[model samples]
Target: MTPVTSRVEYSPIKRARVYMKHEMGIPERRIALEEGISPGSVSGIIRRYPIQKDATSCARSGRPPKLSDRDKRAILRLIKKDPYITTHNLIVAAGLDVSKRTLLRWLKHEGIVHKPAF
Candidate 1:
């Protein structure tokens, strides 16, 4: 016996395509302007509709960092001088002992990759 197979679908993009091609009559800018979506999004739907097997997660967007240049510089200096420094050392130097995870997050936010000293 063979197992059943099913096709993946994305209703929203499909609807967007229909609106672009038929309901809106292939006017990408008009469709986007009237429907309040990006023109790029309209083009993407028309291009990727048939080839895409499933709905892919859109790339995330976000604001810039909260930390200042001074803060990042301080963190980088500390990491470079003693890459083996523990979270406790970081807390002691930076005056924030939130946790190892929080410390790591800040470090990553500053683009400081950890390299064990030992």
Candidate 2:
């Protein structure tokens, strides 16, 4: 027999319980009055809710890091070695297989002030 994994996903209302009780140091009814929510709803949330455990704050991991340390160093080195290098020329010399937008993003991340290409 395989064990079932029971994951409890509490609603925002439920999460509000702990915040109201422990953090806010007030009853649900008072909280609801201040927040403009009904006292009954707050009571329901407080009564039938599980307290949230302290979880490590993890990054959302939406997008990956644009430039690696090596890439950043390479860019800084290139700029320092020759301040006259254009964005187009740098992209070619650095051999970074990315669009001009991506390249610009990398430059921006490295705090490199890029002149508008006329």
Candidate 3:
């Protein structure tokens, strides 16, 4: 069996703990040795996050999406319940606050083609 230490994804809580130890005046080298990580990693974590609040998550790039996965799933459920329903009704049934065009574009992106009523 592969060892549990083969791959390591450090959690934010652990990083916060390290920061707490650092704030207590523990040396980086000693902290690294005790935590089983490189001294450079310990130093990087200390420098990157100025405050404990920022230590929870790293900075991310790019604009955030308009709709969350839950919203998408909800819409998809509504669609699957009645696939031939028009976009306007779909928006109303889904209780989405977005415009018809925005919902249409998102549906297209998700590979759902709304069928037109005769």
Candidate 4:
């Protein structure tokens, strides 16, 4: 009995063929038929070819920071001065424009986990 393998690896030749098809203005379906690969694979290969060739991947964009470095430093100093300060008190003391939820998120990101009293 022969063993079954689940992994499928495409060779450089297949990648080159996809690029060549795109260069020759061939449609994705036709390229898939000729290359014996799925149309989605052909489309993905063409789309990612430039990035792969340049060795540069796309950068991910997330929500911008509400507090700047200086503000964060001030908050840290405030926390250090009074270790038991509540989130609401910290926001008022630091004069931060952010909400208590935002402050808690920032504190959590800074590795300061606060558990509520039972």
Q: Is candidate 1 or candidate 2 better by TM-score?
A: 2
Best by TM-score: 3
Please give the distance, in angstroms, between residue 53's alpha carbon in candidate 4 and its true position after superposition.
Answer: 19
Q: Tell me model 4's lDDT, rounded to 2 decimals.
A: 0.80
How are the candidates ranked when ordered by TM-score, highest leading? 3, 4, 2, 1
On the 0 to 100 scale, the lDDT of residue 7 in model 1 is 27
Candidate 2: which pairs clash?
none
Candidate 4 local lDDT, 1-116, one digit each (tens): 12266734466677877888889999999999988988888888788877775423344466677998988999999989998998888888889999888888878878987677
Of 2 and 4, the candidate ranking higher by lDDT: 4
TM-score of each: 0.35, 0.44, 0.52, 0.46
Q: CA RMSD for every model?
A: 12.8, 10.8, 7.9, 10.4
**Local accuracy of candidate 1 as per-residue lDDT tens digits, 68-100:** 567557667877898888777876786553567
Instruction: Write model 3 residue lDDT over 80-105, tens digit each, in one string.
Output: 89878888898788788888888888
Runs with alpha carbons beyond 4 Å of true place in candidate 4 = 1-63, 115-118
Q: Cα deviation of 9 in candidate 3 (Å)?
A: 6.0
Candidates' C-alpha lDDT:
0.62, 0.63, 0.80, 0.80
lDDT tens digits by residue: candidate 2, 44-98: 5555444433322223345666666787678788989998898788878877666
Candidate with more favorable, higher TM-score: 3 or 4: 3
For every model shown, the clashing-pair count is 0, 0, 0, 0
Better structure of 2 and 4 per TM-score: 4
